[model samples]
Target chain A: GESVGLHLPTLSVQEGDNSIINCAYSNSASDYFIWYKQESGKGPQFIIDIRSNMDKRQGQRVTVLLNKTVKHLSLQIAATQPGDSAVYFCAERIDTGFQKLVFGTGTRLLVSP
Target chain B: NAGVTQTPKFRILKIGQSMTLQCTQDMNHNYMYWYRQDPGMGLKLIYYSVGAGITDKGEVPNGYNVSRSTTEDFPLRLELAAPSQTSVYFCASSPRGRFQPQHFGDGTRLSIL
Candidate 1:
């Protein structure tokens, strides 16, 4: 079964530090990827996204790096804040049409002030 | 903008009961999706709609059903509910594109007893 998965289930970091979350995917046909943040008792919020054509994309304080060679993805958050504490998931789009995403298990980011 | 809204924030159902989870998006996005999240796990797609009158099953759609009558609404129905169906359900919408980010609703917490 082709699937996307996280390298770590949980990551703890101190405020003001940088945090990186990794994901590995098995589907080579996937062309698009996204990162989502889910807080306690809430739905997932879109953070950043990257296409297979590009190696990286940056948001406000977040960056998504894609390595098509190894089928790996990573999300980097600079100056990690307490609000960044949540479960982060990496999702991949299997096709070029309508964009149905396959989500990974998730990595819980714990930021302590 | 009330991007995406889901009704019945919480629900408790007995075995064999049936109910529909309402999802509406004011963003007028053409792509809608339904996903379920279990405790300590990431979200799994249940169903998705590319546009009005077009629907498709996702990763986990065996025990769920969905319909897309219009671009603004996509509801999920659960018939003969089982305990395994208990999870937090989220509705999301996104523009038509290859890598568009999805806007999600708060979620409906369902408990099957």
Candidate 2:
């Protein structure tokens, strides 16, 4: 079965510190991957995305690393802020006839001031 | 323009009731998707459409139905709602391409009694 999974259920870090969230996928055929952030009472927001062709992609304050050899993915947050606290999810797009996304059980990031 | 809009931000339904969760996007995206998020879990894809008049079932499509009659709208139908269906439903859209990030609407919180 194809599945995406996270290594941590919860992560706590001090403000201004760096945070790393890890994810793993079982489907090697997946070509695209994405990370999303969901706050309380809101929908998941797109954070960043990386295609299979790239090993690392950087955003404003976030970075996504894809390791196809181990079938693992990771999100790195630089200078974590209190407002950065939210649940992060990793999703893999499986292309069949149509594109479908498979999400992982999320990792909750808590930034403390 | 509203990136993605979902109506009925919250709803309570009795078992066996039927309702439609309306979703509309103004981004002119050709791909639309419906997902359900359970507590402490990831978003599960229910259905997706590539373009107008083309729809396909996703990983978890048993209790839900969807139609894409237009490029801007994809509605999800829940027939005979069950208690297990209590979750947050989200609508998202993306341009037709590999690694195109999805834009999501604020989810609808549905409770089944």
Candidate 3:
């Protein structure tokens, strides 16, 4: 069955260190990808997004790299902070549904101080 | 703006009970979605609406129903709630398709015992 998944279910990193989270998507037709962070007791928050036209996109302290050839996506967080502890998710737009978004299994990032 | 807002931040339902999850967006976005997050799993699309009076099934539509009466409101209905239905529910909205980012509300934690 077609699905999107994360390479790691959980990741632990020390504060001030950089963290890298990986994701794999199944649908090749998916052209748009996004990264989201979900804190405990809250909903997923938008982090960064990369369109197929670009292989990489950078944000404040985060970066999203897209490898369409392998259907792989990655999110890199720099200078990780204790506040960054949360489950991170990657999503794709399967098709145009007026900005509809599809999600992947999440990876919990534990920023240990 | 309030962005997206979900009602009943937390709810405990007995088996066979039913309830409605309310979602509203003040962004005037035309696209709204309902998603559920399970333990160790990613957010699964329960339903989505393209606009007022238009709704469609998503990746996981079983045991759930949704209706979009206006651009700002999209509600999800759970009938005969089961243990399997226990999860965190989220509501999100985007301006429209075309690679726009999404804004999410604080999720609703639902547990069926």
Best model number under TM-score: 2
CA lDDT of B98 in candidate 2? 72
Native contact fraction of candidate 1?
0.60
Query: Could you arrange the candidates by lDDT from highest to lowest?
Result: 2, 1, 3
With candidate 1 superimposed using the best TM-score fit, by how many Å does residue B27's alpha carbon deviate from the native? 0.6
Clashes of each: 0, 0, 3
Q: Candidate 1: lDDT of B107?
A: 99
- Candidate maximizing lDDT: 2
* Clashing residue pairs, backbone N/CA/C < 3 A, model 3: A98-B96, A98-B97, A99-B97
Put down candidate 2 lDDT per residue, A50-77, tens digits, no spaces. Answer: 9999999999999999999999999999
Which clashing pairs does model 2 show?
none
Candidate 2: where is the Cα deviation over 4 Å? A1-8
Deviation in angstroms for A34 in model 1? 0.4
What TM-score against the true fold does each predicted structure earn?
Answer: 0.93, 0.93, 0.91
Rate residue B48 of model 1 by lDDT.
92
Off by over 4 Å in 3: A1-8, A96-99
Model 3 chain B weakest lDDT span, ten residues long: B37-46
Candidate 3 CAPRI classification by DockQ: medium
